[model samples]
Target: MSNDMLRSFFLGGFECSSHRRADGVRLDLLRTTTHDVLAGSDYRQLQNCGISTVRDGLRWHLIEVSPGQYDWSSFLPMLRGAAECQTEVIWDLCHYGWPDHLDIWSPEFVSSFSRFAAAAAELIRSETGRSGLYCPVNEMSFWAWAGGDSEKINPCATGRGAELKRQLVRAAIAATDEIRKVDPQARFITAEPLINVSGGSGDQAWQTEAENYRLSQFEATDLLTGCLEPELGGRIDNIDFIGLNFYPDNQWYLGGSTIPLGHHSYRPLSDMLVEAYERYRRPLVISETGAEGSAAPAWMHYVCSEVEDALRRGVPIKGICLYPVLDYPGWENDRTCEVGLLGTPGPGGERQVHHRLLDEMRRYGHLSDLARKAGSFADA
Candidate 1:
């Protein structure tokens, strides 16, 4: 773990999603989090907390104003900010935002995305002299279900989850291929929500359905690694890390019902981590996890304990990232979600740090050190 590429045992993440809403209004989380305006200060805060590694994103819609041309204006500040703060960033090349002109299902989509990814990689390498770590297309499964099947975004391909998933997987594969050509040392972290589903009634049919639903979580990663579809050009080299995003309500029973945490029916997060690591045989990260307001500290406690348990079980748990480290406006109504360790900004771009949450994180930071020190070498 000495040369851990993440550069930190504990990590923080900025909410950089730039997805357009159902009403056609794009939500720039970076703006809401004020990271767009205060990235340097945000990175300094992370460093002050001993978190040198972080997750940020590229706003594809803003960057690629035209087909192949790129506008780095929106993202350049954050790039400079990270360097100024001496932070290491894992950039999300596409966080649910693409150029308005590109049809998601068109052949041009994959090529355009691949080109953007390559250019982004080149920029990062040229600035940082590192082959960049990336989550090329974050949460493909979730995006497909929320944005593709539902009317959460443009294209509104209702009931076309499978088709959308296939297209997204193709784009991710192509993006990865293109990135490697530009930065051969690049590493990828494929993030998808990790969940536990149960048959609440315990009926045979529901049980089978629940199992299948749970397995569906790995669709994108499976496609990338060539486990299910070799035609996508997936291979061992395509995957470097497995990022399992967890939250309070991640586990649930089928039919949109949630299984309460600590309930017998609710599988522990530690078990889920082991399952992913054993299945993928790659270093794992809790790519995102946090709760809003009052539950924040307690949620971190629970997550830290589960991650510790997983590490003891020989899982190569690399790092735990506190996502949305800064609070942002909710996508549904622009109402503020007080889920970050830091709160809303003032005229000077200063956010109020939640002392309680900061204390909890610092307290758990010690445990993370031990967890990393004892991780399994096979995945490392």
Candidate 2:
């Protein structure tokens, strides 16, 4: 696919995490933010900011209610809304949650996921006359760490992070294959966290461990590209876009506090982007990036500046997505996280726009236009 595949250079990511919390309450962020009910208007809001492309999700638990049966009732409206608004979306099939009936460790989980993905692809093709872009699984590494290693979320276990990560990779590869069978033109994205880990202490062992931990960030994508584990049915073609989700808290000392942006240990986002592009040689996207209230505008400026620098250095970054474009309730608590350009919906389904972030978006929208022209030159 060309670098211009996405409709816009900037994108809005609707928070669609559907993971169960420690209290056994399954959290659906899309519903929490009311984006599911107001998806059409939500898309229009982004469009007004010149963001025609978006990152959205299909809640697997809601769609695959039973073993073989599928229900799109919870998802169709959002899909139709995007279509109605003339929005381009990269749909995430599994966003950290699954149906309660399936054991995440079982072989059945992989098979069921593949089948569901194929069904979703079929539905998209039928409704929109295009297979579209999809992210088969979101943040496998983080999910494994939170849910399997740390007991912070569902399928809570201890000392099984690696095992869970491999299982998610298998499921992702299976979903890609199945989706391809249904929609041959479909493209896939691997939306993983881009992180930096620094050894705060001078100990050699600490530095070594920190380096290993940092390298582990690429494990999921490496497996998908068949670079590390070929037995999982991974291939180079499985991922067309490398989606890196970065935020202020992404970089940190291995066992200490976060390394603030200006800290010497803090790696520039441009350098990380180039490193990833060189490793995978695939088009990249800032799949998710944003900051909470009061910090949003400055954060966008920083990210856009870094992205432009990376672009100048020959990195093919397709876009930067402002994640959770609509503020939503936090997973661990019900408090609103003021991290989006749009606030919670009102009685009439209207959302309050964060003028500062909107101003920054207007200022940086030209970056996409410039990148598109440059891409045309490169293509020629």
Candidate 3:
């Protein structure tokens, strides 16, 4: 399917993660980064950078203060700001955390999430006079591994990663169905991590283990497409696009260090993109990708180069989103992570632009414009 519905091929994503820490402290990145209060200025900044599309989230825990009741006060401003700026937003319905009153293991969790999605669809259409684009559950595979298996965040359970993954897939499917009932034109994106794992040594058993670990990255996506678990009400039509979240550390060796970018075992991201496209026959997006400090510019350059290569190979690569477009505090240590095009917001929510990275983006934007004009990657 084509992703031409988006207004821009380049997008900015605010750090809207609302997951809780292992210590049971809820982490509201929106508040810590002051984006909750500065969304208007933030969208305006994206427009200045030539980005008319964005990926952001609505805090489900904050919106549904109580069951069957919602307080749109938290999300209304951001939604209106996007509309006013003519920015297209692909909203994340559930980033990581959910209302504490419901048990994630219970059936009520799926039903409640579906209901909330339905309500959100209605609200967005009523306000914007258009159907919404959504990511029902963000990074289900990572969420399962971190929160369910490793106990790194909320619902911090151990030894239940597979179960948690199935639950999340079920919720996503239910949410998609409910949203379609409200607005049949609504589209859903499945944003999952894109990773590669290789064997570090010559041991045969270790090689098999590494390969198995590598392939496990597709479990969540496979389930969603009914390739693994059809009993969960999954089908091919459940997802409209596949959003792959890649980063510098996405490739590694089993139980070993990260593979350097130029290492022999480091697979080119273009190949990974092609593999994903062939496997699902769906258009893809670089949903979340960025780096911190001095490495940010180079990382952006690499991703864009790889994406262009994939596009040239007939892969339906749609867009590239510079995630967490604004600098924010780290989840573990509260240290400032300088990983965005814009630095920390000042007292008035003004941010210092990373001129070098912005320049690279602009350079790539010009190339993309030329490509579009030439009818190259036009459908992509």
Better of 1 and 2 by TM-score: 2
Cα error, candidate 1, residue 39 (Å): 0.7
lDDT of 3 by residue, 291-339 (tens): 9999999999999888877877777767888988988889999999999
| Best-to-worst ranking by lDDT | 2, 3, 1
Lowest lDDT sum, 10 consecutive residues, model 3, at: 367-376
> What is the alpha-carbon lDDT of model 1 when measured against the actual structure?
0.85
TM-score of each: 0.96, 0.97, 0.96
> Where does candidate 1 clash, by residue pair?
none
- Which model scores highest in lDDT? 2
lDDT of each: 0.85, 0.90, 0.88
The residue-level lDDT of candidate 1 at 306 comes to: 87
| Local accuracy of candidate 2 as per-residue lDDT tens digits, 1-380 | 36346888989999999988888999999887888889999999888888899999999998888889998999999999999989999999999999999999999999999999999999999999986799999999999999889999878988999999999999999999999899998988888999999998759999999999999999999999999989988888999989999999999999889999998999999899989988998888999999998999999999999988787777778889999898888888689999998997788888999999989977887777556544343324
State candidate 2's TM-score.
0.97
